[model samples]
Target: MTNRSRPRILLIGTGDTKADELLFMQRCIGEAGGVIVMMDISVLGDPPYKAAHDKHAVAAAADKTIEAVIASGDENSSMTLMALGASRLTRRLCDDGEIDGMITIGGTMGTDLALDVALGLPLGFPKLIVSTIAFSHLIPPERIAADLMMILWAGGLYGLNGTCKAVLSQACGAIVGASRSAIRPRPQRPIVALTSLGKSCLSYMVELKPQLEARGYEVVVFHTTGMGGRAMESIAAQGGFAAVLDLSLQEVANQLMGSVVNSGADRLMNAGRHGIPQIVAPGAIDMVDFPAWLPVPAELADRPFHAHNRLLASATSGPEDRRRIARAIAAKLAEATAPIAFVLPTGGIQQWDQEGEPLHDPEGLRAFVAEMRAAIRAPVELHVINDHINERGFVEKVLAIFDRWVADAVVPAGKVAVERI
Candidate 1:
């Protein structure tokens, strides 16, 4: 392929310090059938060779001069400024369809800018970061782009080495391949955003997915772990969904109760903020998840617990905690500008919360339901069902509201007509 037709990868790094490494990556990318569009984020000296977008151009993008950026007080502040400039320029490049994908090489400072750049890019645009701290806890879930790729910069802290070359080559090749192959989340049909855990915990998606598909809507299910909810909220913030079925709120509980295993504070508020039609439930809201490798907190020592896996575990919260969560959920739904519904399954929320299960607690469930009943007010319709959330009745309740909304033209109708086969 010609250079213009090849996948053009935006390779970002401090060219002054990483010229050798960046040049090697550019060569590798060329061999892998991709073209490199180099962006120099260095605030210090210049690269030996010229870059397409130099540090001066990066600073200019932020409406500041390179001198002003260098004069910024500390390294963190300077890098942050450069990150802002680079991110703005990169966004413009993507918007203008000048670049197909991006890859950045960095230690802590470069990685920090890399995270910002990744978050700034549109989802599914083939962003990758070769960082010394890939997968490190130093990076928070909210800062991560839903589709960003990362690889550990093995033996790459200093100059180039054999191990570093291997990592860099693979990262370059991966970004090139991804740019050529990534399937973006296009609205092929009227999209329905659904949130739930695995079928074992919240089985609504199992029935809901096929049922929604049959209605000629495309169903997108999000696992409500920390990152999953973040992805959903990110998409919702972009006004990506025709209707949102946000049935899982364990991440909300996790955030409220001081567990790191949570989405950001704005978990249940994105769709509402964007005025997207939403149907919400308290799926898995009674469970507070934490790292299974850690000891159970002293406060939750006596609560019923379920070991989800070696990496994740959850404990059923007390009545008071459930009441707090109910209030929070109510407050979030109250802000919806478009149509919204909250379904309260009085019997139970998740499978494990049923009788004879590990997390069964009727008292806690009652407290949550009672609090929800009190907290939910008009304009935000509350449908209290006697069946568990996983039951067919609960699904019917949701579908009834959805069908009405579609009929009333509140939610967009499915793009495809139902085949009468």
Candidate 2:
């Protein structure tokens, strides 16, 4: 292990502990050659130290300089203490070696403090929490994304026995082993953005996955939820995407009609501003999604509502409403300098919008498409395909349009060389 890089470990212990207990843990860590960069004992209500003589040897603890940064004498002050400690540890990890893993042991407050520090790290970093409250369901799953291990102390910190020592030692060894192993890097692929609803657009994604991959593109699908739409737009603004296949434009209607998945006013504008090529489709544009009838609000209660599921209540868009949505979409589309194409699936936009379905309204659909075509000043091609939005034929048409646009935008090799020095 002398030639190999050691994984940096952060051990956080809370509450007053016997000196012997601290010495035992330190000896085990030192024997493993794991560099203990930061040890936070702020929960013990004791002053931070430089180095202390344990039973095995002298172990270096966190310096007392951190106390000045955590001068706020409140229970919530633990958060600040943990942040400072984690920052120091991460810095040390970045210095000579990579952070293979991080481990912390504490009570309820300590768990909260340690989890916050873990969340600040990137997605792939390893984190382990040994907590008295580890078994509790109160823990938020979002706080633990990467490879996180949680060990529940059955009888709390005071009940530590031989079993506890073995558990902690095993955890240390596991983290060290993980650090030495090589993680295969994913191939960098051009990102292709797609908007989808689990119900309506699942089939489209299944059919288009191979097609996009064949062209060396990584398709990133965004559920047309309220926050999901905003996330996709943010990525587009960051220039993280090669092209956008906006299959589900229902969130625009949701915004106007006060549905749950409303993407605000600036849904599709970011891609346009970034000058990214886009292929837009009116999937699920025929309806607006909401919760139950009780939460539908008094203003929209009189509208014709249908229960899509037990939780989802939707209303079919009328001709007037469709026209408004179309004009709004066209207005946003007109701002794009990049090549844009709007494909209209004439047969149906969603599962319920097909023939003999409850929400099928071709008159309203036609009016919407007509208004959109009239309003857009840009080259918004309207393809009246006979298949539904999720159909294989519809996916093929979208891929063709995307291929044509991509080809036209490519700079010739000879022209590229002439422009360069």
Candidate 3:
């Protein structure tokens, strides 16, 4: 940790055009007990005041000069060079422990660069982007960093206004506050990355979390929703987990079905890429989620639907969809370099898929089970547990596999804490 008292915030923007807004945010950060480190990315014109790192410095960081950037001859190409430079410099700052957090402001162009910069930093570092299209669908899921924060830059396109000031002030305060309070991940025990939905749907986390922790593993359960799964995959890509219990496949189903509630294309492959031993399950793979507020799509209109709430709803997939997802899951697991185990619970996958629930489809469940049986083969061991996913027996099956792996030295053994008598 640095000896400095106040958090240092790196503020990046096109100073030539957003001088007033940048200066306003600088003052706001100051009042919130933060020091602003300014980096100007303007190519054509300069801001009224000098920035700590100007366009020439940014261009040089990319191994190019300001003249070379302007010589690129197009806005997109010029900005691409600047984006490269800004991301490299921001990462250098973070690696050197010079900046505590980062906040960038802009419309589309600045937001584009901000995404690259944010993605370059490690997880748990505070990175905020105040943009005109903060949550717009125009931004792809893969471009988003796991811990990035964003606020809509309302009414601040051309110049500052009362509404814009309100938004900017709140954003500045948030960045400063986050920088001060952010806790970097420092697990005491080895981390086990677990993925599941709510307790109402996938209940294994309820039992598995405490049991795993008692056995001296830190269980970090990701919700397997679109963003949650993406965050887990992000951390896993960095080799963050000792092992992965990917017990939910809803995001994969969402991706195959072309739903907006889907994680990126690389959903189920990250942990395996790092050779992390993982236990995989098809929990909730029979259903695809869409926003509840919207009308059901025509193709799935005839399928059994369940409204979890006003915000989210799910429709059961047909037998064919289940078969297709099974093959897809198997293909991803096939690429794993480490030991992989696939557990299939024959009775039911989710709470709502049991006998009398709204989403009850015994035939659909059977289809998934049969296809999974045929698809999972070779290096990936398959365990067919004939119990509902929420059943005690199913939990035992998972722990049994985990324990065997630990004993065989495939997984690191959990350490129970001992107290001095």
Write model 2 residue lDDT over 176-276, tens digit each, in one string: 55544536224276678888877543368777766776676777888886556765776676566778888888788888776655665778887878988
Count of residue pairs whose backbone atoms collide, per candidate: 0, 0, 0
Tell me the whole-model lDDT of each prediction, alpha carbons only. Answer: 0.91, 0.65, 0.91
* Clash pairs, model 3 backbone: none
lDDT of 1 at 105: 96
Error of 2 at 184 (Å): 11
- Tens-digit lDDT string for candidate 1 (186-305): 667898899998789999898899989888899989999898998998888778889999999989999999888888888998898998999999999999998899999887899999
> Where is model 2 poorest over a 10-residue stretch in terms of lDDT?
52-61
Could you tell me every candidate's TM-score relative to the true structure?
0.94, 0.56, 0.94
Better of 2 and 3 by lDDT: 3
Give the per-residue lDDT of model 3 (tens digit) for 1-421.
5323599999999989999999999999999999989999998899888888899999998999999999998999999999999999999998999999999999999999999999888888999999999999888777788899999999977998999999999999999999998887777789999999888899999899998998889898999879989888888888888999999989999999988987788898989999899999888988899999999988899999999999999999999999999999999999988999999999999999988898999988888899999999898999998899999998899999998999998889787799899
